[model samples]
Target: MQSIKLRIGINHCLTDNNDLRYNGETLSDGFVQHTLWKYANWIPVCLEIETDHIHQTLGCQSEHINDLSKKYLDGFILTSNSPRHDSFRPKVGLSKGGTSASNDMGVFARSLSLKYPALPIEENDRLHDPLIRENFLERIFTSKRWNIAFSNSFTPHALIQFHSSHKFLFMSHSVSLYQEMGRLVARSGLLTLTELKDRYVVLMSSSLKQMATPNKHTNVMQHIMGFLKGLIDADEKKEIVETIDQYRTGQVPWIVPITLLNLHLRKNSAADWVLNQTYLNPYPAELMLRNIV
Candidate 1:
């Protein structure tokens, strides 16, 4: 089956190729690479423009904040100099040449998290890192899966099976989340499917966020490969070690080892269950997301 195309909400400036700073110029075409532009559907959101227009009608920023909550967005990638908290609340910048926090895109990075706790949000700055980009794409895909799964004829067994398939990812990325999922799975009989799914999605989003952070990078590769250490031959083992070293040195993308491991796993019938996992190959292989070095 093919992966669903995600609807990604992006900052207006990033989309329009404009820079919102006082004397800033236009953004380069390479701001967002062609691979991402071609892969996902981007919806530009000028929260500031909407804010400026609605400010007079609503008469208060708090009401505008409430209004922003109503927009339908799967995930948001905010550009730099974008308003933090979606409000130019503080006079951090001036119209002419002075600085403004509202105009500072970096300040607005985490605003979406506070506003929508379950929403997957990222900054354009962080996407330059392949690992972070991979994590962001993974989260949106999982978010869409969660949305579709819950909005359909979901059953308790399905939730359990879903948890089972994705449990390896949590185990590899976040042990605490792996344990939390285990505990939640145990309560499947007692809890409603909706309740369980809600809790599971929240934890899943949290786990993706946790793994995306820099601190978890070293352990993620180690954890996944650790499982395959005994299953592969000496040559495969050597390749994995070299791949991991290359990844550590930034000589290759983080996915090189994963792609290599996936290839190795595919050859062994004993690896069918692990190979069948959704998170292990979440995105379409056609995207070539894993193929690049």
Candidate 2:
């Protein structure tokens, strides 16, 4: 049998100890020496660090930002800080030859495109073919920008939503804002997992939830329960429970990854199961489906 060629990107904070484990190993455990071997099948993308000195006091340097972008990411998801609702809108360049927000994004996109033509650039706002123009009209009329920065920041729930349709997922390293935006994008359906199962899958960063939070001992159980309660039905619930049991038994090492779970939820098979399960309050399920649709 051929090995599955799926590229899964995880965006995370390098500083977070939990995030280090998702890369199949820890940073302290020979991250530098065994970098490729540790992340053998995954593409580790780092996120640009946003600090008080860089964003506030000294102002951001375009070269510094560009250099970071070049070194870490092939693509980026512009967003706001998580845990704290920091604004996604940055001042752009430094006191010297700094760029504006739009200009900076354009420069980054252009630079990435020029360097790696294979990677496609995607942001919250709609842009022209080359993705240079900010499309002020859409920005003014729609709330994609607002959703990008604040609501539904990066969570496994959000990634499940995103990979519901797209085959490949890309994540950055920085945790504050980009991951939050990635969550929103995944939820909003801007980034979807393609149904083409044969396509190559690529993930930029490592899995944040699995890495940052311990699998067996974390709040993820609560969150997963909430998500399952909100969606799963009697028959599907039985199946999911069985699957979870198998996961616990080590029969299935990775119980359906959250990405697949969300995709299953969106599919007709799970949808039918959901409709059949009568005990669940239909209102919340209805609302959730409506939001996704």
Candidate 3:
């Protein structure tokens, strides 16, 4: 059997001390790097160090470049915000002397190309196409849309559609999670008195019937309430009921359908998910919706 080989690249600010948090790098950089390293076995390809003093500190030479590329050149991950980095080109022509930051990335790209001509270079932004972004939010949030434009080389038409349709561009996970719960309510079918009680009982029970309940009609609201009731020894089920009753009070977006779908499907694991379903089908959307009714 042929072993599956993967080329993983790290795009981060390599400081003298390898602190994962509370450094000069953006929070998103830390989050993205942490998630990737935690889930996948990626060999360090090209470390796009975000720094002004790259030439003097890192000692960028042809021999050193060849050594690193020969050892781990599969792809390159660009970290800095796209606008900040791209804007520098206009202010200071595409020369090495104008801006230290722009020059650093240019130098790194050129050196990698010179040393390893055949290796494929990829960035984090390239992996997060618009479809991937929508899919990611879909599973996690019941009702929210991610509209923010990513600062990477990869851009698809679907991503533009998401940005145009949504009200906000950026949102935190906590907010997104609540919005997702709201979506579960809106999208769920109306249940009669007996049906609602039966659904509630199934959600509360640990039997196979409960587990078999499809996520679409699982009555997450009641489940959440039951869980909470157990914690405080109160009528937790009432809390869930009350929350659902007050659902109209909260602001929910129409695009959350996309976000919720993406979240449940786990879009970040697209590559792994694709490999797992090689015998079944290659279409991600089809595989994702297989269980959804």
Model 1 over residues 67-164: C-alpha lDDT tens digits?
Answer: 55665456777654444433312325555566443443233444445567788877776677666777777777777666566555777777777777
Model 1 alpha-carbon miss at residue 9, Å: 1.5
Ranking by TM-score: 1, 3, 2
After TM-score superposition, what is the CA distance of residue 7 in candidate 3 from its true location, in Å?
3.4
Q: Which regions of candidate 2 fall more than 4 Å away from where they truly are?
A: 1-222, 228-231, 255-260, 268-293
Query: Of the candidates shown, which would achieve the greatest TM-score relative to the real structure?
Result: 1
Q: For this target, which candidate reaches the highest lDDT against the unseen true structure? A: 1
Per-residue lDDT of candidate 2, residues 70-108 (tens digit): 333323332222211112233344455564433223333
Ten residues in sequence with the least summed lDDT for candidate 3: 139-148
Instruction: Give residue 12's error in model 2 in angstroms.
Output: 25
- Which portions of model 1 miss their true places by more than 4 Å? 1-3, 18-33, 50-72, 84-115, 212-253, 285-293
The local distance difference test score of each candidate is: 0.63, 0.32, 0.33
Q: Which wins on lDDT, candidate 1 or candidate 3?
A: 1
